[model samples]
Target: MIEAPAARAWPKSEAESLPGKLIIVEGIDGSGKSTQLDLLHKWLVSQGYLVVFTEWNSSPIVRSTTKRGKNRRLLTPMSFSLIHAADFASRVHTQILPALKAGAVVLADRYVYTAFARDAARGVSRSWLRDLYSFAVTPDIAFHFDVPLDEAIRRITLSRAEIKYYEAGMDMMLSEDIMESFQIFQGRILDEYHRLTDEFGLVPIDATQTLVKQQQQMREIVQPHLADIERVEGGDLAEVLRHSGLRGRYLQQPVWAEASE
Candidate 1:
């Protein structure tokens, strides 16, 4: 099983209580992380494993605030970074840690590395952002979906009606054309992600491959770590507990004060 990167500080209380596994898929936008993670979640559940899925920027606490800021185009680079950090912190306490303590497999669509790449692309200091996320519990395995910038753009623009302002880094004024700015901006994030691969021990999955091939590779890597829990009979909570031999320890969810506007 892939362990958390050795450099990050893992809280002892969290370390001792963690009976569950956290698997994360990280990549640039349009890397198919959500699609792959959804399939993985379904496959795991079909095999009788309790899985909890979380996506980046889904925290209800920050949802409207972030959306409003983005709509207004009022978020500076540092503000955007901080807002996402708040969203992540909330999810870690409310969703990730709780499900993990319950012995469920936690599947994350994106992790802190998203911030590391995107914020740095917007000129935020990588070290400052990394320090901002030091309280996060690292994942057991973090997969980075590597796709070419052109390919990623083709996929996104083909699938969606239009790319949003901030999504194309229009706020940076890199180019008058949104598409051009997207290419240059996302290219930088992609390069930053490449650097992060070695620094954070991210397993790079070639995203240019066929969907079936990619899913097969993901399953092969995932199957081994879950061997112990795979034997549990499907759908009986009691049986699941008995088979996995989990004490079902509860995690004390952190009480977060409301984020100031």
Candidate 2:
């Protein structure tokens, strides 16, 4: 039996090459991304991986888009679409790419698919949205948390306990008229995810399981890649991880700490 070898710890930036992995967590609003991310982060750390967890739209550039969601006003489909696309672009350049290049596994709460689903649902052209995101860094792995609409709504409602502005009244858009729109849009996003996986060779996990269970699986998926990443990018990895620790060197994206306010 040819069993896979165990993972090893080594300094980065001493290697000739490294394959950094990008793990993206994706789902509609109210899905358990936050919980899964927390669990995944802990598990990855346990595995000796330098895991960095950040959420989409949490970057400074993307946080501004939340203004539209909170304004209780309907923006022109095109305007809202462009806003998120720009947000995604800034995040890719500022936050995601740097971490991936440095060799840390980036656990993103949401990603390109958010733009695919949200924009298209508002009657925007999917093709146009794709063009906007053409410049974003694609993930190495994208996990889609599948759940029934009602279940997702329930989960989101419960999650709103802290009352963040983005989470507030998001359920108001769940009327039956829009429910179909949500499903149709969500379906398209999933389809896009499948296509992306096929084209880019991404790993997708069924995340409907409990957070503990999901994260455990996440560990399995990511741990296997670490050894290779280290072997190739170990030297560079150490440097990037080191920079990530120092002030202003790692976080290319503006941390949306204000969003929690």
Candidate 3:
């Protein structure tokens, strides 16, 4: 069995005392993180867990600034790295830390490791980026969905008309064509993620599997962590599924049942 990265001293002493568990799913674009996280959130809610969801770059403080910089293609690699770090810091204070203190399961779409990988790919010093995010608390469970480069690109391009400027690494000027640039840029990021898998002890999930299998793998890994959380009354998972436009009927069955059927 693959073990989590060797335990390191958590930066914030308060985080060590929190009763909640932090679970994170990370990968490049089109790796199915959001979909899997939504499923996990609903399943945990059905099991009477208090859950909070947070995503990368969702902090209000730096959203506009990052957007403007990306739109104008004005952000240097260092500036891009720092802006995302700022966004992460804001969320840690306002969103992550508080939820954990309240004993709520915190499901993050991406964490500081995302910065470590992407920033380093962009030529930032790995040690410097790690120090920049030294305040981040280690997640109880971190899964990296490993998808093939071609498959990820196919999924992303099929959904959108064209890849965004920054996502394609157009700023790096690696290729004259957008697709070529995206391939080169995302390939670098993917390689970095692979390196981080061993470095950080991220559980590798074969992302090319059917969604059902992926969710099953997620549940298996998450079940052990959920053992300590005391039950709590909260939102209805069925209603959440309905509101989110997921197939609501699945909530009637056990999570495993949904996968088997």
Candidate 4:
């Protein structure tokens, strides 16, 4: 059984003084949260909102190191957790905070809650993980996409030929068979996610619903937060993208511009 940490106060509340909003999503892999976030990003962009999107563990500073470790299959559970922490920190400093400071709505594919769930599932101390991410700004809205373990497994299997090593938690040695390990490992992650949802007051989204329905529900929840926020003008869009580290990604003119035309 995994050890539960003593209850502590939630991380600092959202900084209301910041002009922009931080919106994040959390869930086990294959829960459809990523798809929902993509749709949300597109909709916000189409409406001319300045949106910055960041995904977990995408920090270039540690990307090569993380890749080498995973390829060599040398990441112990603790080391794996720490590497991800570093990636999160770098992105927070370089990408997330800057965008928030610039008044762009920042959408995170996963947030610190991801480490809280995945690392604890790997047997890292929960309290330690929280402290490691103590510098993180509280998100204005955190959505948890809740899906059953069986359904999650089904979706994953259908989408890929095989599960990757660390993704299946094979490093923990729960099972030799990759598929079996994935089920057990992801089950543990799902359990931790449930605990995090209640502890952090995350808004729960039913992942089993049709895509259209889920998106409708998300837009409804997100609409009020955007009421007074202004749309990004063309010149301002470039500045926002520059600070977001996404200028290269939008080099060919943004699709949103065409949509507006």
TM-score of each: 0.85, 0.67, 0.87, 0.89
Tens-digit per-residue lDDT, 1-261, candidate 1: 433343343443363458788899989988998898877876776666676678889888899999999999999999999999999998888778867776778888889999999999999998898789888887878899999988899999899998889989999999999999999999999999998898888878899999888888888787767765433353554345435443332212122223111
Question: What's the lDDT for all of these models?
Answer: 0.79, 0.56, 0.79, 0.83
User: What does each candidate score in C-alpha RMSD?
Assistant: 8.3, 8.7, 5.8, 5.4
Q: What TM-score does structure 4 among the candidates reach?
A: 0.89
Best by TM-score: 4
Cα lDDT tens digits, model 3, 120-218, are 878899989878888887888888999999999999988998788888888889999999999999999999999888888888899999988988888
The regions of model 4 sitting more than 4 angstroms off are 1-14, 233-236, 240-253, 257-261
How far does residue 117 in candidate 2 sit from its true spot (Å)? 1.1
Cα deviation at 45, candidate 3, in Å, is 1.0
Ten-residue stretch with the least lDDT total in model 4: 1-10
On residues 215-261, what C-alpha lDDT tens digit does candidate 2 reach at each position? 66666665555666543222333444657542233333211121110
Pairs that collide, model 4: none
In model 1, the Cα lDDT at residue 31 comes to 93
Q: Could you say which candidate leads in lDDT?
A: 4
Taking the tens digit of each residue's C-alpha lDDT, what string does model 4 give over 171-240? Answer: 9999999999999999999999999887877888999999988888888788878886778655556565
